[model samples]
Target: MIPATETPVCEAAGVRVVRAGRALLDDVSIALHAGELLAVLGPNGAGKSTLLGALTGDLSPDAGDVRFAGRPLKDWGLGELSRRRGVLLQDTATSFPFTVREVVEMGRAPWRRTARAAEDEEAVDAAIAAADIAHLSGRRVPSLSGGERARTAFARVVAGRTGALFLDEPTAALDLGHQEDLLRLARDRARAGDAVLIILHDLNLAAAYADRVILLQNGRIVAAGGPDEAFTAETLSAVYRTPVEVIPHPVTGRGIVLPLRG
Candidate 1:
């Protein structure tokens, strides 16, 4: 875990957003520190994606500000911002017939004409291997399944090699094995000093992999802390409006959440 004193790669302070007169985020603040995996969890329409949009500068906050590496987000040029952070949104649609390798190579566009451009091939190859998409390298992107397309998009982000990564529901289309693989890869990235903020609905996955968690409801943070502190039965049951149970793992002692079924 990163010390609280360390400067965050990205931070939002007292951010607020209103759309069509309805507040989407209210007084929201969060930070992404190097070497830490922060998970954002909330029910549908809980402003999880709004927070991500604010942090990424895709959606301007009505009230507060976002800073990237100590500089206001507005100060960073598009190219520099691309090099500093990689974002993987929920949609990864492709209209063109670009091959998987071609799509991944596009991630290096921001580094063009720079010294880092020399590393493009190496980076792309490594990303392909990391995402386990080498077999689909020559396949056209539009031909791939939802999960395959997701992996291809992730490979593109991996090839970018940005200092911070923002993934919004990246595991939604993935199978059980791919979900584990992707989260493990994300955890590895955090361990290697990348600030990673991911939005997830899987309570167990967040409990297992997140260093810290923020649970949001009605555009406000309902809870924030380590897994053990934030993921109690009482907290989750109330926030999710469902009966749930939290038990300690037999070996790792991490919390395991199970929802009560009829």
Candidate 2:
């Protein structure tokens, strides 16, 4: 976990987004610091995606502002922002019939004609291996399964080698094994001094891997703190509208959330 004393790599201050008389995000404020994996959790329509978009400067807020590296997000050039952050959104589709390798290679576009361009091939190779998609590197994107396509998109983000990462429901289409692998990789990235913000539906995964978590409901933050603080049974039950139990893992000491079942 990053110290609260450290300055954040990304920050949203009093951000609000309204669309067609509905507020998607209401007075939401959050920070993403280096060396920590921050998880955003909520049920459907909680504005998780909207928060991600606001933080990444893809969606402008109707009020307040966002900043990266202490500078306003609006001040950064698109190319410079691309170099500083990599985003892996829900959609993982290619416009053309690009191979997995080609899609991953596109990540290096921001670094072209620069010194970092020399590392492109090595970065792409490493990202492919890290995502375990080397086997599918030659396959066309449209030919791959949903999970495989998600992994390919992840590999592209990894290849970008940005200082900060935003992944929205990255594990939604992944299987059990790949889901674990993806979170582990994201945690590893945080440990290696990158700021990672991921939107997740799995409470246990967030407890296991995230350094901190923010819970949203009705387009506003209901809780924000360490896993144990935000994943309390009462808080979760209230937010999810379902009774749940929180227990500690025997070995890791992380919370294990289970819904009540007859």
Candidate 3:
């Protein structure tokens, strides 16, 4: 649990979003604290991305409020908000050919007024290294593989050095090893006093890394709390409409959820 003395970096209260006569999100409230990784999990059309969008200011809630550092999101100007939060979107595609280094360097645009040349280069270098893309720095983004492009996008976000990270299906393109690496890096960032709100489809990954979980279904928050609490067999089977089993991992004692194949 987040300590009572600490302030949440971002928070939502009764946030709702509507589109095309459907409530994509409904009265969802959650808090994101520094040094913690909070996972939003649900089946497709469950509004996981909508919730992420609402929290990140990409989409405004039709009702209720989203606050950043105690103030409403509307009050936080776009320029400053962009600097305080970094978003790793579901896609980072570009038709124009840009070197990986160039793409990563673009993250510094928000801080250009205050950043020195040396500082910008250092940050970009560190981010590239952190994303394990040092070897691909000179490669054009359009020329890279899907997983490589995803890493470059992550590098761009990490280069921004935002206090809060909003990752939407960040591991969608990676192989097993890279998937583990990316999640571990997110864990590392959280340990360094960064607030991470990640949208994950894989229940096991959420169980392994998230400090807490928010389970959404049909635009409502079905559960919110620790992995063990949020991802019980009953809840999973109900929300996902599938038979599932939640068992303890052999070594870590964390919940290991698996779908029961017929």
Candidate 4:
């Protein structure tokens, strides 16, 4: 857990976003403390991606601001921000035929100066090993299986060694085994004092991994709290417009959800 004296890693206050003359997000506020794993959840068109873009500096909010360590995001230099936060988009495609090692090494781009490059290299090697892709390092990215490719992408972000990580549907293409592996890695990162924010479509996965859940609906935040507080059947039904059941996980005791036919 982050020390009480340290400021929140990231915070958004009354954030509002508009795209193409349409309101995509409205008056959303969130504070992400260090070492917590937060899951952003909602149905399609809920503006989850837009919210992430605002957080990662990809999109500037028309109203309100995004602050990092109490400083406006705009005030932070690009390289400085990259070193503090790593982002993984939902659609990651590499058209170039690069080796997995080469792709992972790209994470070091933000720290290419001074002695940081060497430290970045060490971090890359550690990340590859953690992702269990050391053997595939020499393989071409395009030649790998879907799961292997996902792992490679994950390794690349982990190699960045940022204090905060934002992943949008990172496990979408992975099989059950690989998905579990990735979640374990995410948990480890949080345990090691990194703030991880992930957008997940799978309620079960979110319940299993996230310490907090923020639910959105119609481009607005509908619920935000821990799994027990936010993953109730009523909240799920209202957010997704479908009846659902929240059950206790047999092992982890976390809230697990199941769809119910009306």
Candidate 5:
């Protein structure tokens, strides 16, 4: 993990990946800047998750470099990396009978040897509250609903205090209200100077919350810019292989992406 005083930045440069015989990712590069929410969006098979995996240090690129806070990802010790950034995957299921608090406290594992145990506990409590899972504190992880479990996973990341957050499809299992809640939390995190990168299938959610959007197609970034520039009708139609329209939100005036019916 980068020191607390440092601005966490994760970047991939000229990244390439091949599985079996075919190329999965080709020369894709991006940088996650501190205090901004960068959303990665694309159609299925677009390699969105693959790019995320590489950026998070879970996957190694065949060619190119990935850096975390100015250090090569491979050079960072696991313990230190865990302390500097937290990753929330798309599927956060656990069959273990651990309680919500227990699962949340697991985030503090890396910091356990430090003298800041009390501070860790305080952060855990705050994360629980922030996730709105405080009422389910004593409940077992296996017994909670999908949305609740997702929230618990989010709380774990929040408690980690890592200057960066990488979330993959966090809103997939959430209800409408919870979906908004999660994205809003991402906005809040970025505002607090954390480098936040989220992979989202919902373009509207990305349009509403992300300060920047990266549109990927067939394992490459086709567009990278603000929502208005990244999500035009022509780009969406071509990349998604379907016709669509982009119009301003009736009230907010931000771009709203919607599909066109046959």
Candidate 6:
């Protein structure tokens, strides 16, 4: 758990987003504190991505406010915001031919002007190594596998060296091994005091790695708390509209859910 003394890195208050005259998110509020890994879980059309878009400032809310470090998100300049927060979307598919190194270098664009005198080469190298893609830096992005491409995207975000990271279905295309690696990387970043918010479809993986879980249903937050408190069998069954059994992991004592057809 994150210490209470550390202030939240991002906070949303009474946030509402409407698209095409329909409310996608309604009066939602959340706080992402430093040194914490928050998992946002939900089924399709649950407004998880909409919430993230609000955080990234890509989509402005129809009502309410999103603040970073106590300041309104709109108040932050683009370059400043990019340097402080990094966002990784689900699909990074591009036909353009760019090497892994070239792709990662894009993250450095925010700091390009002022970072000329500073030695940012080491940060780039560290990010590649952290993402476990150091060996593929010279390879072309188009030639990489889906999992490899995901790792490269992760490296690009990490290279930005932001204090907060927003990952949208980061492991959706990854294999088991790559998923584990990606989760570990996010966990490590959180432990080092970066506020990390990730959208995930797999309840089991969310239960295992997240310090706290936020469950979204019908574009609203149904539950928010630690794994055991938020992921009860009753809650899961109701939220997902499926029968489920919440079991304890023998070693970790964390909650895991198993679907039981009625």
Per-residue error at 75 for model 4, in Å?
0.7
**Inter-residue clash pairs, candidate 4:** none
Error of 6 at 27 (Å): 0.9
Candidate 5 residue pairs in backbone clash: 1-80, 1-81
User: What does candidate 1's lDDT look like per residue over 1-262, in tens digits?
Assistant: 8898988899999999999999999999888899999999999999999999999999999999899999999999998899999999998999799999999999889999999999999999999999999999999999999999999999999899997999999999999999999999999999999999999999999999999999999999999999999998999999999999999989999999999999
lDDT score, residue 177, model 6?
A: 84
lDDT, candidate 5, equals 0.91
lDDT of 4 at 140: 91
Report how far residue 226 has shifted in candidate 5, in Å.
0.4
Per-residue CA lDDT of candidate 4, range 211-249, in tens? 898999987899898888999999898888889999998
* lDDT (C-alpha, whole model) for all candidates: 0.95, 0.95, 0.90, 0.88, 0.91, 0.89
Query: Which segments of model 1 are wrong by more than 4 Å?
Result: none
Query: Per-prediction TM-score, please?
Result: 0.98, 0.98, 0.96, 0.95, 0.95, 0.95
Stretch of 10 with least lDDT, candidate 3: 110-119
Each prediction's RMSD to truth: 0.8, 0.8, 1.3, 1.6, 2.9, 1.6
lDDT of 3 by residue, 3-122 (tens): 847778998999889999999998888889998999999999999999888888889889989999888888989889988999988977866899999999998888877744457989
Model 6 / residue 54 / CA error / Å: 0.6
Model 4 spans with C-alpha error above 4 angstroms: 3-6
Clashes of each: 0, 0, 0, 0, 2, 0
Off by over 4 Å in 6: 2-6, 115-119
